[model samples]
Target chain A: MMNPISRVAKSLVLLFMFFTLHATAQKITPYLQTTSQVLELPSRVLNETRTIYIHYPKADSTNPNKTYPVLYLMDGESHFEMLSQYTDYLSRWDVNVIPQMIIVGIVNTKRTRDLTPTESIINYFGQPDTSRVSWMKPSGGNERFLQFIREELKPYVDSHYKTQPYNILAGHSFGGLASVYCLLTHPEMFQAYIAVSPSFWWDREYILKLADQKLKKGGSLNKTLFFSDASEGVSDSSTFHTNLLKFDAMLKAKTVIGLRFEYNYYPKETHMTEPMPAFYDALRFIYKAPYK
Target chain B: MMNPISRVAKSLVLLFMFFTLHATAQKITPYLQTTSQVLELPSRVLNETRTIYIHYPKADSTNPNKTYPVLYLMDGESHFEMLSQYTDYLSRWDVNVIPQMIIVGIVNTKRTRDLTPTESIINYFGQPDTSRVSWMKPSGGNERFLQFIREELKPYVDSHYKTQPYNILAGHSFGGLASVYCLLTHPEMFQAYIAVSPSFWWDREYILKLADQKLKKGGSLNKTLFFSDASEGVSDSSTFHTNLLKFDAMLKAKTVIGLRFEYNYYPKETHMTEPMPAFYDALRFIYKAPYK
Candidate 1:
């Protein structure tokens, strides 16, 4: 039994409150489960400005002082988000297959220089490319790149983040060559290695020769490795498929007791599409056991 | 050539600028490719506040008026980011496998209530649970849930966002059951459906019987579907595996035309882990051709 004026005023007030609440509740915020940081790292080793993307595991309330294993990824600009998403999703409380690990994506400043093991004028077709501006020019700075990673990037990440001793180095294509090369040349740098279609064609199959040399060195190496190839191996028509096979066979002939490895071949998938599956499988293979 | 005091002053200035640049550049921000909005929509159909997470594709400068297919994903809290990341990665300028999609994630308030098609006391082992405080007490409100999506949610999305005519419904586990259920009952709602390990054992195989009835109706269904099962199928001690087989066979026996479908079986993976690969495969299968 309110009067008309009173009822009207009450309705207007109610409407105003509802709209205010509605507007506040409708605040559009980011729906991200985890956060990542981008650092513009100055590198004297490569003489260039390097971009680093780091995705740390979300702080666990159960263990505040928990330290995580570090996964150093190459081709950050291409696959950083994909790896970060996988790590976050797979290491979830309910979906706990892989342990929580910090992902440090090292973006390439110079692709050919940092990834290839040796310098050469040779192209993919077993012919020398004497072009004025070859894509493979200014190459063979991988040793210096690794020095930068080991001395500068590793130190920076270790001092800043909650990191465990276990380290994994992962990459695709030329970056894959860098990963496998690091395993042979500097095995102490990483506990595990993932090479998704390592380009062995560089410098007249330098990686295959390097692997052979490392095997001949006869040092008992304790490491885990996962390498893969895609349809491009055959379509390239330059012994790309056979090179991968030879690499696999060379690893299998390893008398080195502590080396555990798996090689996957994606016949249906192309070079680019292969990473999508290869990365997932590599993670599964590497993190079969949760790291403490 | 300069005095000691002047040199010291110059060094200090340089150091100060370096520190300022370092501090500003080190300002950690979110590394998200796209932002998502969480809208608390008041649904009159369900008489509750429905939480919706919508991930719209980044604005394309080339084609500002581009409308995207909306993927209505159940269990937004679990797999929304995965779908969003996959869509972003696959639709990149260089690695263009799939089209950019709008992911409308429908998180559940009452998972059991909203997902199941009918109310029943029958459990997974075909046994009745008469407990007073049962998990399935307030069950079988899926029709109401669909009503909410259709009457309230879909209209809200269509009006507010840049959505095309094509719609996709995707879910896993009980959510998977809902996706399939929606297809059989309301086939016109979405052009594509993805059900990862659907629970065919719900309420004494009601979904199986429903499929039979739908098949009997004999109307042509022009749609794309991708369904899969994992290790839990055989381990459940029920007809989960066989039911999935029956569903696949029934679909294959289709006198009705235009239903393009693929059924994948992952024997090595668990139910929880299956979604990782299943969703990726589903996306690849549905978008075999880039959507216009």
Candidate 2:
């Protein structure tokens, strides 16, 4: 054999060539074969341009004109890929726990403005002439935001894609708050709602009060809802867990006709980590349907 | 003003152009900004070509040269993206539940042949598989498969990726069988093991028998393991659930030195759906250590 130094150099050259061939020659494709699209939506209601991520079911040869129920998810930037992956996997032919549905992920512009129900400077701890230059100011433009969805986004999505009339609204934290607010103010919007760790303490429980006022006892409101909390505020004042329990109890007491709801508490998970499992379970619960 | 029909036509035209711009002018990036690479690895040990998908942690400007723990996942084609997404999401600055892990997904070729341990044609219901061209004919080549992993795959990964000394092995179903086999036969290959609903029923419980015979009364097989099962066999003969219980009990009784293990039972989930939660829980369990 030749000297060790040259041998090492020669081996490196061969390895480099091998990787070069592997990189360029191989038919490298994305791990997830996604036909997902990013759409730019201009809104007159909010007077701004918004970007939304849309994930549609892979074209099925079996169901050529198959229309899908749409799940409108919030905080698209953080969890769009996640929800896309979950929906794709769970609805696979082999693992058919849930139905194949379209996902419209609404990316954030002014999160605090759009998600909250009231323009209050109040903070999470129940007191605030808050911190100077707090990002939580200019809150609560939910009505105008929903108008954008109702008048513009929904029509656009329905016109562009193959969509069923059935709709599901899903979100976490502030987005969750928006989902609850939508249910109270505009119950006709979605057939199902998933509010994972909703910020229910917003503006002295405005949505909670709205729910109590709007949800008539034994009323004919047909809906499926899944709300959950993970280790948030269970230790101290228990505001988060307590708020969820209060809402659950309120729903039970009302016993609204055709309304189905479930509440799950995750003791181990945190706020940020809860969405993955919560959303999956929500889909499972929502689609457990001889849906109307 | 335009008539209703013309208005509709004009709206459609505008919508088309809007989508065209959204498609063309806008920088529409893939949801998950991935630096993942697909490598075609030719293995001498098994005499087959293997495709491995590698998901690295995104470039950290702060720690540009940082090495990472690698998780070798079987059933690469099925769960690679899930694991990749999980690792990415969990290791995010906001949702810091687990350490960032490099996932090396080994795509299956002859899945049944490679994953099974004993070369027997026995079926799950404790009968000799007598069907014409039973898929279980080429039952066992796990030793050689592990050899391929140890000799070819691991070295390739260590050399190619910015990998730490620590490694984790994860799998489900038959893939789970391979994971347990790797633990028993080649514990040094990985620091942690995840076997989600392992097929202990393989070859009249070959893995269980091996666990019985090989595991000393008080052995020093220091390793971290998380194994779980979902809604399986608990209704009748309970072979699947019982097998897991037996293995769990055996481990506890043996009390192997430095062996930290946990068994989880998910009664609500099915075998096909268990991997999503199990793998997430497994990572949580394994990396709960200030790892050795």
The DockQ leader among the candidates is 1
What's the DockQ for every one of the candidates?
0.48, 0.26
Per-residue lDDT value at A274 in model 1: 85
Q: Which lDDT value does model 2 have at B81?
A: 82
Question: Per-residue lDDT tens digits of candidate 1, residues B1-292?
Answer: 9999999999999999976775565434557656788878878899777888999888899999998899999999889989998888888877788888899999889999999999988888889989987898789998999999899999999999989999999999899999999999999989999999998889988998898888654567899999999987588667888889999998877656888899999987888889988999999999885544
- Highest lDDT model number: 1
- The reply for model 2, stretches above 4 Å from the true place, is A1-32, A130-132, A236-238, A289-292, B1-33, B235-238, B289-292
Tens digits of per-residue lDDT, candidate 2, A1-292, equal 7999999999999999977865564444555447788877767788777899998888899989988989999898888888888988988889887878899999999999999989988777677766778888778798888998999899999998999999999999999999999988898999999999999988877788899999999897888889999998875564878888899999999999998899999988889889988988898888774333
TM-score of the A-chain for all models: 0.90, 0.89
Tell me the tens digit of each residue's lDDT in model 1 across A1-292. 9999999999999999988876563344567556788888877677677889999988999999999989999999988888988888888889898988899999888889998888888888778999989998889989999999998899989989989999999999998999999999999999999999898888889889888988754458889999999987578677677888999998877656788788999987778888888999998998886543
